[model samples]
Target: MASPITPSTGLGSGLAIGDIVTALVNSDKLAKQTQITTQTKLVTTKLSGIGTLKSALSAFQTLIKPPVGTTSKLQFAGYSATSSDTTKLTVTSDNTAVPGTYSVKINNIATSSSVGTAAFSGGSTSAIPSGALTISQNGNSKSYTIPTGATLASVVKQINADTSTTNISANIITDDKGSRLVLGSTITGAGSEITTTSDITGFTIGKTDKLDATSATSAGYIGSVPASASVTINGLAVTSTSNTLAKTLGGVSLTLLPGSDNSTTTVTVATNTDGLKSSLQSFIDSYNAVVGAVSTVTKATVSDTADATTGSTVTPAALTGDSMPRSILSAIRNELVSTGAGGDLSVLSQLGITTGQSDGKLTLDSTKFQAAMDKGLAGNVQQLFSGTGDGSNGLLARMNAAITPYTQTGGIFDTRTTSLNKQQSDLQDQQAALDLRVTTLTATLTAKYNAMDLIVGQLKASATSITSFFDSLNASKS
Candidate 1:
């Protein structure tokens, strides 16, 4: 009729049942947990390595083949323009400019046409009779309606509101006498002049006259006619509607300064070897950066002492022995050494870019590069690098093509990353399942041990009761 005694510490059974159950559960889960942890770490490290490699490749690609609306540092042909007298005229040249010397004589700079209204006695607030005002410029005319009780300032604002259509703008110029309404044309050419006709009373407009005796106190046009830039290049006369003579010479832009009139200057265009050399050096550096990344990820280190836990003497990188990085490196190296269809300077070695024998990095031979430039092979070098605008011929183009597969969307790197992510997820699931199994096992073992302890306690209790009864009976018999 006695109840069984069950204690977690197992006092009745003389054993630590709780500790035994814990030890058994741990023993069952340790191996599986260890495996899962190791695999997850490896997957995470590999993914990080892949990301680093991809980033390096993308940077290199941007330098060589930049995105749309961006220009690559590598120019097909570079040129510099020098002016004999910068004060007289300044010149700039682009890749399209031909290397040559030109004798430029600037006659006059272009001037904009301007006209002003007679001084108003009422200043900016002077009222004018409401009427229609028409402004004409470059054969285009636009009419503006002057509102009732319009002031000079208000009329100027109204005129300016239609500036885009009329090619004219109005402003209020105030001198010691009074305020005057000034109108100027946005364009400057022989026939592009601002002319206005208005029926508003007290509105008298005339061209500005710089030569008039009282012109200093009156508002008028500065010159008699709209002027254009007059210049002669190499004994040929050239007229431009703007001071900036962009179409006067191929690849050359000349700006006629104020003091440049009646003065002659020489513009010299030459090859820009310095710019080309700098770009070439940048290409070498970027290429080497990619190579360095690959080397780092694929390196294996032999330690002097073995790791205490793993007990391994050789430590390999996450991507060590991985064929992806090695294959990428090999593909790019092939492009660097391969011959191109470009003439004369078809190979990188011709431009002093050579691969290192031991480290696989590019080295620029300054002496060889200068010699090639001195030999007048700069154009050929450019051709080798930039090609003829076609996408298939140059070294940069070929290198871009070679690495596109690995760096593009859903490419090799992406595929590898996806696989690694799935592997990580699967490992996590395995860990979860193992943890669940261990939990279940622990509960089952604990229940069984508790049941056994209860049985032992009951047996001991009955034995003690029987022994006590026997001792009592023996005493009675004695």
Candidate 2:
């Protein structure tokens, strides 16, 4: 097929059969090309959607991610310069602390726990252990089998072994022969009462039978109470319940210990997180999806070929060219891999997302990736994707922002669509003009040919009759 010609080449200067055929073939080619170009533009639009969605996700993730391992560490502003030497500094967190220069030595730090109470002994023989006290809370029940040889420590080991509950400890007060089994509340505001479905046998309930509770009042947060109680801490009259008395004095903050009053304090802090680890994983996921999508567009698969005349299928090799995938890859790489005056920040590799020399595919050193993200990942991620030009910052944001201009009237996409529409309109007008021209040509050719056919047919008829008459005349004359 010949390539389509523009309006300037509509009909050749000289009219001929070859020229007419050429114009038709060229028109078909132009139409196909326009369709392909439009489809490419549409594909770009779809990819923009993918890219923007990813950017939005990245933004949200960047905002909430805690700074490295800082989330796990307890932060207190003020302590007496000589407090470490004078007082015992204890670690409140259960997990082992990371090795670092301590603000104070954690001397004589005791692990947080609850002391369990003694179990009730003896159950009625036919009652199926009914007489023994059963501790029930939140629909979960556990029977205390106080054996003849049962000790408080043995019960504590059993409760600790049960994975269903947390922090259950049992200890004996040997001076009073009173065994106390303490159930530690895994969370704050846990219910106080421990109910029994079975009878309490050989066990006496005392004023201390109730579980010891850690409350907000004991923690010294007096915001709820209006009347100020005078308490002298290090010879300082701390009146307010919520104010940082220690912090006000020489930028020092006090770490308030948990109280045993059973009221949960409003100050609930998050535990330390394994920073950078999770961030690296997310980046990997997004990066892989994009890479895979590009690979799919660039690679080709085998297909059966069709014969031109009979349309029979056969194996045939054909060359196909596609630039969309490569263009997308380029856009992403240019955004991520370029360095700027913002320092040496460029590419995922610098931030620990390395690519191999052989394949040029992204690989992650999780430790490095996490550390970077934890300490300074937000700046790095933004820096990597930021674009060149005055005020066109952040590669993803820049590209997504650029998409709006392409969609506007007379923009690249708009212009192409407009141009294609004009081409189709002009093609239709040309087709209409061709209809008239062909009609005129057909009439003129048909009339001239019909006249010749009619003359030849009549002559043949007359000759046939004349031969017959000649035969008759010959016979008569003879």
Candidate 3:
């Protein structure tokens, strides 16, 4: 028998060999438990990395190989501003925006002018008979009574009605502190000029000449410009009554609005080939960014190469640095540089863009590239990145179509994230069970040790009792 060690210090000699062995075994188990916890975290991170990579790859595939399989198309149109008359509006069919023959209609016309009037004297002078005077025009009538001493202002009031009347409207025009009686025809157009047909008894035109009709009229005109502006559309100079011109050419109609100068307007038409080539270049740029991100996480890393003797694949973690990212980028760069079936340069090199080997970055010779573009080397750059469908095939349209599925109630990303949450919840359940096991094991182990300690104490008392009894018997014999 050995003395057991005190629980606090493990220093007594009453300990069993099994107990020491259990303590050493528990220490090794704890080390393994720590490794398991670290590995669990690594697994979770790898899951997230995989999800992001899938998304990036999906985006890259969609860009590189477009589903529409056709390039984009674009046409131009303009508006006419030759008519000063703002109300001369135009309408079209469909968009009626086509360049065929379209017409405009005029609405709401007007004009203005001034006229002369007579004055009266009081007390029945030679100029007038005094008392009251009547004024009439075009079947309308009004009366004014001349007082014994009527002032110029009083005579003026009779001629200028404060408000509306049947034949014509009358008012006083004032400036600074001075006032002049004015008359205007309520109707529109040049025919609406005001004139006094009848005179009052005491009033006359007088030696003081009447005011000019033009002086009272407004300056601007209401109808469309009498003349039209000349606009040359695709070499066809068109004379339009109004400023707006809608015309069609090559199955597409471009509305030609006379430019602001209203002089010679020049419009340049882009051919279909030019439009398609421009569209293709845009696709290449977008695809490269996404591929680069995915490659960063999927490549081999430094930690993976460590502990190779352990026989495990030692995938310490997925590649996370610049080297792998650039490698993946280079793969995509190689694809773009590969030659197409036709054209002066089969690949992007023909377009004056050369890829660098170290990092897959591109260098553009702008002057040379522009020269190729000018010569139509890109072969309808506009068509490559977009489809010619009416309102259905631009880059935005294609991206929207692809992303629509992910937004649906049961979409892929939604399902995947939900699955991850369920897995994490299950792991939490396992952790709880493990915690209960640990608690129960600690309690049972402590209870067993306490019982063993009590038994050892009992044995020690028994040994002492026996020794004392034997010594007493020997003393008696002596």
Best by lDDT: 1
lDDT of 1 at 235: 95
Predicted structure 1: lDDT: 0.82
Residue 314, model 2: lDDT of 42
TM-score of 2: 0.35
Residue lDDT tens for model 3, 400-425: 44544443457654665576567666
TM-score of each: 0.74, 0.35, 0.44
Query: In candidate 1, what are the lDDT values of residues 324-375, reduced to their tens digit?
Result: 9999999999988777656777788877888888889999999998888888
For candidate 3, which ten residues in a row score worst on lDDT?
A: 74-83
Find the number of clashing residue pairs for candidate 3.
38
| C-alpha lDDT (0 to 100) for residue 183 of candidate 2 | 50
Specify the poorest-scoring 10-residue window by lDDT in model 2.
Answer: 216-225
Q: How accurate is candidate 2 locally (lDDT)?
A: 0.41
- RMSD list, candidates in order: 5.9, 18.3, 16.6
